[model samples]
Target: MFKKLLFCSTLPLALVCGSCSSLYKVDKKTYVIEVNNQNETFNNLSKVSGVYEPRKTLHDTLTGNYLLRYKYKNETKYDYLNNYFYKNGVSAKFLKFGIIDEIHLVDAQNSTHIFNTDEDSQINNVSDFIHPDINRGYKNPIYQIQTNNHNSINSSFFNQKLASSKLIRFKIKNNIYWYNKDKKTDILINSKDIEKSIEKANLSSQQTNELKAFGIEKMDFKANENNSYFEIKLNGNFKAELFLDLIINNKIFSAYSDKFNYSEYYLVKNDLKHTLYKSVNNANDIQSVLIKYNAAGKVDKPTHAKHLLNEYHQGLVSSNLLDDFSDVQQKQLIRDFNSNKGIKLSVVQNFSNNIVNTIMFKDFIDEPDKNNIFEIMMYGKNKDKNSQISQFYSQNNIDFRNNITQIINKYTLNFIANKTNYYDNFISPNAIISNAQNTNYLKVIDANDHVSKGQINLAKNIEFYPQDLKKNYYNAESFLNVEKQLKSIHFESISKNLSNIIDDFYKENSNLKNKKINFILPLKLESLDTRIIEKLNKIFNEINQNLQVNIVDINSEIAKKYYNFSNYSTNNTIEYINKLLLTSNNNLINALTNSNVSQYKILNKTKQLLNKFIEQNKITVNLNDKQFLEKMSEFSIKLHNKFSYFEIIKLINEIKLLYSLPYNLSSNIDLDSFKYELIQPWIIKPTREDNLIYFEDIKMEGKNE
Candidate 1:
């Protein structure tokens, strides 16, 4: 018997062989097969016969049919003498060796065969032939069927390819969109390009629907998420621009926080490049473009305006600057006037209409416009007292009369009412007593130091003013005194007003502990004068007692610690000790390692050293000679025992370097002292709450009158 391995290296190997006289020469090929194995195609197996008999013995084997056998290496096992035995399993078949030779299955077609090798089918027992599961396991028909099933599963599992989406990039030439090196031309737009890609791109579903109610068209591309391509099959060709919008996951693309760059997609029409225009909506969505189609700038204004009006009517866009007539509304004012000659007259007519509707003096019940009131007050003050204001009105063919009470209400009381808001809201909130001059009319300082022109003060008893009335005369010294007196009264008024607001705020919140109130008054020593301190004390005392608000004075405590160190007291020494323990770990350990102290020296002072280190008082204990040696001994043990022997030696060397510095802090302290204090064995108790105001200073500038 002769065994020869035949591998497919090149197609149709040379038929000549030296051992042609050998009988039963089996041709074997190597195949390694297991679960989920990758199969490779044999390129040289194209020339072979149809079939061969596996058990057929032949002389002159060069002319005999080719027998195909697959061999795989199996795990080794040892026998009784402890000798190793190498085994190989084989699946052999004699088949037609030729190009594209298909196998014929002759088994029970309904039954499937699975290869199962038993452990007892050893080479040593092969001659015994007691077990039929190995050599005589199945018939030739069943073997053919199993081989066919194996080949099919291996081909399907190892050779299958998956499908994926292809990216198609295009560029526009003139108005045509071209793909693939200009070999293909395609129309990329639908009628909904503007409605979907631009207008409805940023609009919410409800907003889009609302615009749709007004005959606006919108296309949603979300239905094509699973489709490989947006196949635009145009029946009859019409001109389509190469305009594109980003479609992600078949939805119109959006990036909320970043600026979406669409500049690359804009096409140049004429001399200008046209990009998608963005109009911000009520929902703050940037609707990309408003026009349904791309149009140049020649008539863009009118077209855009019309679209804007449409969007506005549907409540998609609001706050158009021309919603009410103003001078800044461009030439839109001309659109309202029917005749060119009455254009100026129309302006005056609109003004008069607004005045007639808005200005009313009788009853003086409702709030008057303070800005208009201030204007009227200034206008009335600048007018002549000898002639009537109606003279010019009659000359201009305008029949208008200013009511006496309305003039007084608008120009005086109403003007002051406007000023009162500024004083109450801004000045009172910040505790500011203003000294700025109001030079339009006779400036008067009231008893409360509230400064306004006498012409505008309705509370003043002055019924009328002279047209030539100049500012009230005053000597510098008396003016200064009165100003000072008025300033004090003004501060008092502001304080009272603030108190009232605070009281009201507390009441309105259902008296929930107003956690929002935090007042930290940082002051210096120079500002701590008697009067200012008293005033501040009174204010804060009232706030703390009534409002249930307490402001911490951490600065004063720090200041006291610094300025009065003799009387100063704090638990910060322990904090410092704890920090030293953690932060000085490396250096302290090194110092102890190198020190010449004995183990007993360190242990003896462990407790005493820790107590002294973290003492709140600044007193330092004087260590006796014996105590010092004991502390050093304790220090050496505490550090030396904790680490490895090599680490201890290294720490000792590092400690030697540390002691060479200007000061040796750890020279007297034991390691146990550092360990105890550093770990922070004590807890800090909270301080009792009290109604004491701590501050450095409170200066009352330019003393109160």
Candidate 2:
């Protein structure tokens, strides 16, 4: 839902009684705009009878001339209407229609909600005006009819059947809010402060709302008599199907209303933008120009020239600012400008810069609605001790769709839109979301205080007592850490958090019977703390309880995994280590080697580390692991052979250091466990037990076992 709702109690009202006037005519400016009709995109029209508003209604509202207000309820003629206007860019009507919207009558449009039937989904709209929806009672039983027939209030037929084979399958994201009205507030996260960083966004909430805010069923934004609430385009048709409902005793109705707001939207350039920092912009229309500059080149640096973004630029992320003119000037032109003091607003904005980017360059996003003004990314050049903006092109808003398409084409060459929806990973999306307090990525979380008598230990690090965890800090640090470690090391993200993992673990194995087992994790944010707030609110219902989620901090996950490893690995240590080290090898698809990409990568990394450690420590050792031993034997032969590639040995050592494997595997030993089972596969000592020999790290601990 729209967090900032504009309720118009003093709004203009109209009545729709299943009839309306024609919706097309010349306005006062003689600028003809096709008004709302029935069928898709919502309308506030008074009536909808399939065809476009009849000419009869048009004459009734006109001053003896065709008026535009008289509209229809059909979207079929929208295209023809646009062509008739022939306006520049887009027609007047199209411009007004920004967000998509819709309206639904409990019993009129689809009475299924009134029946409360599992098969038919019955629902009853309250006719009373003094109370909320729940207090209202369902009208006396209406007649049930076979097939697609509807029953009125007077009908009392029972056991009548209705066929729902033709019903639309609406994708409802927040079931708690949809079914249970009381839990509605559960969705809205009311936090005045929020981190503005794309990299740190919890996308789970956003994806859920996306599924709810839209539907495949074609509806209209009612016009005129339709006290319009929303305008949704059904399959991109904006001409007809626009409808709004009249608030009859606070109930949504289609018979009377004037205007409607919609949740649907057009593709605007206000979504996201990430560009080189070097391209400084002194743009009056900073938003749009940023779009254009970013489009022209795959990279931008402050060293080139100032950038100018038009008003169309909604959300923008400036990653770097280079002082080199060549960086911004392309293959030609070297004029540029930038504020040496840096963009003040960005620094004071209370924003979320990519922790990585921040780590790369310490910065933060500004809080919105404050002294927060966006940095001016301009388009200008300096010469003769004077600076000048590019006069060749007039000011324009950045067309995000066009620029994104262009950026993708230029970078990817022959790119296809995949699940990632990005041209390349050159720019991280996480940084974009987190940098701006993106409402799209907002989530609603629930937290409760604990009063356990048990001892608990809480600290920044996990080296504390476990019992004190009942009041754990939502383990936010773990989530942050998970994201950090994932992007930095895995080059990927943990798509789902530990909560989902627990469910999946049980479902897959079907043997675990644990309950009330909570996980504590850390969420790494520079602010040091992030609160659990809700996004879209849900109406909490006591009797009808739903799956209450506790977003355990990623740290809790790490902690759980850390603590549980002993028990889990006790049963399957070798398999677990092999899986952990060989993750990349398993990633290889359809290859001759069963080895995963991670396996090869870890192996190479291990090689680098081992070699560096040996050289730095001035110690030498040999491993009898099949791959390690073979590589060592090859390295020995390379020194004396005339035509030897070596293909192993010291090269493997070089690979080890690069990976940063544990310096002393023995440190991970389970101090309490008597068995040597805790650390194997990955922690064996250099030994004479295999084909190779060692001169470092002394005797092996497990040889006797």
Candidate 3:
């Protein structure tokens, strides 16, 4: 069976009743954010006829806010207040009507925050407190409901139900075993002995009595028509649900406090063969004793597993930066949890260019305190170029939001501008219009193509038509230039608006310095031809004459590195050698083809290798061949077709030696010294020569001397 099991943790907290005021004094700037309100907490709140605050309460004298903290009966119980104004940086009543029954998040006149709920009446004050600029969550929230109702639960009911009844499912298999809670000998049980196993299993007197009365239903051990194995189901009574512990053979398997169920049994599947189940007592205990831990918050280079994310987005692999999850870690986590093997944090941050863009994670196992909140601390060179680090706490901190906006804006602008820069500088039809290829042809055609108007009457005004045509050509060019100017203006406008928004955001909170705009320019290389190379040489010669242009013959490089006769021919070694000198049919007619069939195959492989290199390197071929550039074009193409790797290297060295001499042979003041200083250093001379053939003991003259 191919099944994808998703493990999710429902965070549960206690529901304490809070009294409401009759005359609600709604402050304009105050906003209320709600969390974890779909379980029994909402149910309990709906049942209450009157607003009732519990007797015991803690009042913050400084902030005029009351915090109702639940005393945890045990370690698993959560103690955070059911309702309290999360502390504001300033001692102001930012949450005026703190977490009311019909919560409305108000802000001055433009009240943008609204919490969606099941009951039309369920909505009042609760809102999601994400960064105002981040319109969507990093990943959308996925809800897996058992029933078809698919209703959004209210705050109080969700909180209470989640605390008591949460279910975790695991798949079991035949011959599967587990180590005990105390790490003793392996305990194995069959489907028939399951009830007897529970009876003899480790449990307190109260738990034994509870299990006996609840009674383990005789399991359907006979595999279904599909031939799948049995599943384990946990059934907890109301009180047992709070401190429910699964003890197998004096070993605690699993425990849950906030685990509750509307139905009696929560099912676990035997999804795989040879699966092992865990008999651990506490979740925290399992983590510490079993898990091979990777510590949190260490910045290091992380490895990524490949995933085909989307079909629509296709670009150069180097161009697209992705924030992807590690499928290896995720699969490992799932396998461990299902096999009763323990689980660990497999958190990964995906980034490009040293900027952390996305973070993916599994669920948390810990309960929370009032102080429990997500905090991201960023430290780098600030806008002022000062060495400093800044801490941004969630809620009541606008500095964090401003900084986040800056990062998003800067990155997005750079992405758009990079593409535009490529088009404007090189690819666009109108780019470098003065150097356009077809302009001379257009002028020649205009001069030659003329109409004889001797038959036309003088009064017909034919000259006006010619004038109109000329005016239209100039107008179109002007229009294109205007369009380019407008695009440039639009980019400037967008950048200015972004800066203004950032400035206005920090106006009230002026502790932050303005961010510096950093533009990343892509490293670009132009297509090579003889003319371009000569022009580059002239520029280099003026600046530093020692530089020389070298073109490596990729085909020869491939042949030299890797060539075997067996790779191309299935014939015997003797036959392959004989075929090298034999004549080939008309099929071998390409530029690099020759009379020999075996040699042609080798040459074809070399050509294929060179083409692959060209694609990967993003090399474009120059095709702007004017009359003056015809020689350069023919020479470049000829070298590509005729020369092997070593032959081209030899040609370049020969040209360097020839160029080293002055225009007049006798003009050099000291020929030997000039060769040592200017000529020999540029030449890669062979160590020894035999019968005009050079060997590879190449050395530069200046370095060796």
Candidate 4:
């Protein structure tokens, strides 16, 4: 019995919990509430109990109007009314009551207050309160109201006359027309107008072809009274949308008209081909015009107009002084134009092009072939400061100075020793030999270790000397010859080092991939003695098959000969000779070991054996040729002087000094910086000769003459 009583109590509690957990559905009903100007009546259109809440009043700042906020409740619980008035000349009061939205507006006199509300299903009913004449369709009522007010404000400000009937304004180029929206009339842009505009544009053939491809010939404009919009018709294989986009975004079909006027404001094209807007009225009113243009989508932003006008005025002033300005003044103007942060980079680039063209043209008119424009602009006075070329380089972010310094540092030896014409004057073996004779020859001295008053003779007298004296002289002569050979080997080792460095530079530096450095030896290969030629050919052939070292006639026109030392090795000749002697069929060892013969006979037999060995091995060089010996001696001295470390370092220091200056041909500017086609005429052409060696060779080595 106790268990049954407990079950009964638990069943009641469970029943209560189940009832609490079950959801109760309530039907929601939307109410359209309207408040009149006097705020007197609260008519309950829907007979709901306690639906209205206490109202909170607010004031509008524009027309001193009043708004009310209310809270209420439905079956689903809480509901609120949100209402507020815009604080502007065009006042709008918005109210959200329950599930309904409403808009209230008053005229300028505050005499009438209009209120309209829409249910959640028909939300567009409230827009009727803002403007009853125009059908806003799907657009926001607030935006339409603001646009109408803005149009009115602009019309009043600019003194524009409006017709009594609603009219649509169309602006094409500088021509403006008005059409009645309600009336049906023939308004069209014919093919003749398009043809005339195209003709007036003076478009290029490419532009004409582009237009033709766009179906410009089939394009026509006509007014659509039903839709109240202008219709653009294209009949050919063209997309109307794409044509419209091109017309709107690009200057392809632009009319040549540069000046546009509306009431007191006018947009005029400046000398820089930039359009600038101004007002014939008060200057302070220009900002208002810009604002109006911005609102109408005529301008992007008001601040952009100010920037454009600033640039346009600067361009105008500079253009006026083009003819009368001196070179100094023009240069100063270019500097000023570039330094102005307010100016756009594109505008600055255009100004640089103009200034450079003017200066170069004037310079050419005054003098040609004497003063390169690059020299006048880069190396002239006041070059340290910014100029047209400097501005162009800076804008492109090209560090010519750094690039040139790197190239110079890498190829210092080539710059000093690689000029063909300068080789005859700067690198003479005779001068070096004469100087060495004067400084190194033995001088006669008295007992006190001072020079004697008698002249010292240099001729050898070994023919009349005794056998011991002759043997000593011969040993001394052999020692001197060995010393000379050692010197020659030392020079060849230095040349090898230089060649390796050059090869590495060529492989590593990508900037020099297309560049070539020519080393034109003064001696003609064809004019050299046959034995010397053969030895040179053997040396060239045995080093490597890379053909790095080349022997051509001095007058031959070999294109782009970069100094290459890959076909050279210090021991190439010696190794070749050793190989030839070891593998040859001649009896060279027997000739050397012949103790039965006299010394002269041994020497003669050794020469014959060497000649026979050379023949057998197909070696072309002769060891006993007088002309060959003289030519080889001259070449040895020339090579020694050419690879002198002291001379190379001196030239490197001079190059460093030249590059360290504020301006030079390589470090200052280049034609690559000026991308404009109009400036191409002023660009100096590089000669094949100048490109072989860096142009600085002509300047520094005095080879320009």
My TM-score estimates for the predictions, one after another, are 0.14, 0.17, 0.15, 0.19
Deviation from native of the Cα of residue 49 in model 1, angstroms: 63
Better of 2 and 4 by lDDT: 4
User: Between the candidate structures 3 and 4, which one is better when assessed by TM-score?
Assistant: 4
Per-residue accuracy of model 2 over 337-438 as CA lDDT, tens digit each: 122221211001111111111000001112212211111111112221111112101111011111111111111111111111111111111111111110
Score residue 652 of candidate 2 by CA lDDT.
24
lDDT of 2: 0.19
Cα lDDT tens digits for candidate 1, 338-434: 2332121100000000010011111111232333322122122223421122222221111011111111121111112222211100001111111
lDDT of 3 by residue, 553-616 (tens): 2224322221111122211111121222121210111212211222223444534543454466
Worst 10 residues of 1 by lDDT: 672-681
- For each candidate, what is the lDDT? 0.21, 0.19, 0.21, 0.23
- For each candidate, how many residue pairs have backbone atoms clashing (under 3 Å)? 29, 200, 36, 0
For candidate 3, the lDDT comes to 0.21
lDDT of 4 at 410: 14
Query: Who is ahead in TM-score, 1 or 2?
Result: 2
Q: How far is candidate 2 from the true structure (C-alpha RMSD, Å)?
A: 33.5
Best by lDDT: 4
Residue 13, model 3, lDDT: 17
